[model samples]
Target: MLVDIGTEEGNSWLGHIYNLQGFVQFRLGSTEDALSFFNKAAEAFRQMRRADDGPWLVVNYGNLAWLHHHLGDQAESEAYLSKVDALMKKYPSPSQDELHAETYAEKAWTLMKFSNDRELLADYFQRAIKMQPEMVEWNTSYFLWLVNTSEHRDDGLAANILEKMRVAQEQDPENFCLAACYLEQRGKKREDVKDEARELAVKVLRNPVSSYNGMRAILRVYSNYISIDEAIALAEEALELHPDERYLKRCAALCLKRKIRYFRDRHTNQSMIDRAVSLHEEVISLYPHFSLVKNIDLANIHAKSNNGMAKADQMYQDLLKMDLKPAEKQLLYNQYEKYLNSD
Candidate 1:
């Protein structure tokens, strides 16, 4: 998963990525690979910070100490322990009783990717925020986590989550991703979000193209509140700008699917269904391990078209032959039953 996170160098999260890769390697019992990745993470931090050491290394050092301990190398483990001791003494925690904010922040960030224990991680972010409230990025990440994991509200987020997003938008004024999400929650409340959504589209479009996911969020606002045609146009424009972007293609395909299947109240031409099918097929290939839902979507959309049921049936048969887990088989059968019963 980390291997596909783009090839952009000098990324701020490169060190975190390396550190996480090391952790995953160690978990898989690849001690040598884990050590290599841990060392790479140290080097990544040193190069990015233009320094040999800082509080950021605290977590990396702890990982090394634990790794050596696991390998039964007491001497090397103690060496890393000494380094952690010196770093902690050099940069004491703000509360003296609590951890350094960097450690807490890194812990929160890494665990977000690895663990589903949101309550514990939320506390970590909170501790980090309390120790260093000026870190706007930490604040933004905290609020974003809350927004994503919050209870689903048909019309909008819960009141507390809404307030967090509002505060996050203010703190992260230039974060079009958060801005777009805020617009969606507001739109769900029946507010007039079209103008703001349009303005946000302009800002997101003007920004230099990168791998940031703000564009996806903005597209959601358009898909839900604005015209699906306009949403498709925006998604197509994005795809044209970055034709090789699998993420953008996936988003575009989803937008097209919505217009085809869900928005049947409106006119959808054969050309639209064809584009949807083409996009879904490519996406299915592009993400072979994660394409079950896409396959079902492709089948359903094709089944709705003239003389396309044969392909749909063949796809379903192919899925039936795959060694899906029992839970996956249950889901596939559920969806397949729906498809078979459809007019």
Candidate 2:
């Protein structure tokens, strides 16, 4: 649909669509196709000849570099990386940071996926927002991160951030900022925001934005503010759209676990626990280095269900053997103790 629209309307619209397609293809592991789409996107940007638009091409070049590296073509990867450096130098952004908003957003997102450094992730997100304050997705992401990190540490700071997010939502009524803002309010247990948050969740889920980040933002709103069932449903819809998106799969699994936890009755439904466990297993199989937190959740579910106790014990032992940080180990022990104590 985006391609069809782009075909009818030539210009920066086409360039942006091609860039999105490239990212989607890259996520789907179609490296060669992604490279072709990125090349076309760059050509489109060059044809447009917008001074500021050249900086936008940095993401395409960076993605191409990463894709080439993954394909074991070190020379081609280096060439693309060099091209990105040249582009940054040739078309410097107004921030003079040597890195564009796209680069910062990409780094922030990658860190969120694979790294445990929330402070660094927050820094990158802040830089992206500073460079492109008008970008709704960046604002939403930064706000979410602020809320996550500061919810218990500093209520005053979190309130200030929420106010800023609320102001941003008011300025751009149609963007995803409203979703994030209302969701934050809901997290504070404010009854006034519940209806608005639900409305925004439905609105975003019905007509989500075109970017992967946009989809993830929408999913986050659903998972955090909306019902767990709704979150799982929205995740399933997203996975149907982007079948190879591991993030969506992970989100779905997390939502399923949340749903299970919502039920105080451990014997509510055996099938539900089974489905969540299966999803977790699938995630571990697909990404071996994935976070073990989900595995801990799975073990807890098993123990609560009074089924697969042996497997749960084995999982707990495996987690203990891994070299985890002191905090992480303490968290695992706490969760295990709770699981053991649960009726």
Candidate 1 residues lying further than 4 Å off, grouped into runs, are 1-14, 25-52, 64-81, 94-97, 206-212
Tens digits of per-residue lDDT, candidate 1, 1-343, equal 4654432555555677788998899999999999998998899889877899999899999999999999999999999999999999998887767889989999898877778999899999999988888767678777667656752667668777788779878987876667877888888788889999998998877654544446777888898788888898998998888788787788889898988877865378788889999999999988887789999999999987779999999999999898999989998999999989887
157-251 per-residue lDDT for model 2 (tens digits):
44566678777666556555345544555565544444665666566555433432334555555655565566677777766775665655676
Q: What's the lDDT for all of these models?
A: 0.83, 0.66
For residue 207, give model 1's deviation from the true position in Å. 4.6
lDDT of 2 at 295: 80
Question: Model 1 scores what on Cα lDDT?
Answer: 0.83
TM-score of 1: 0.84
Query: What lDDT is reached at residue 20 by model 2?
Result: 72
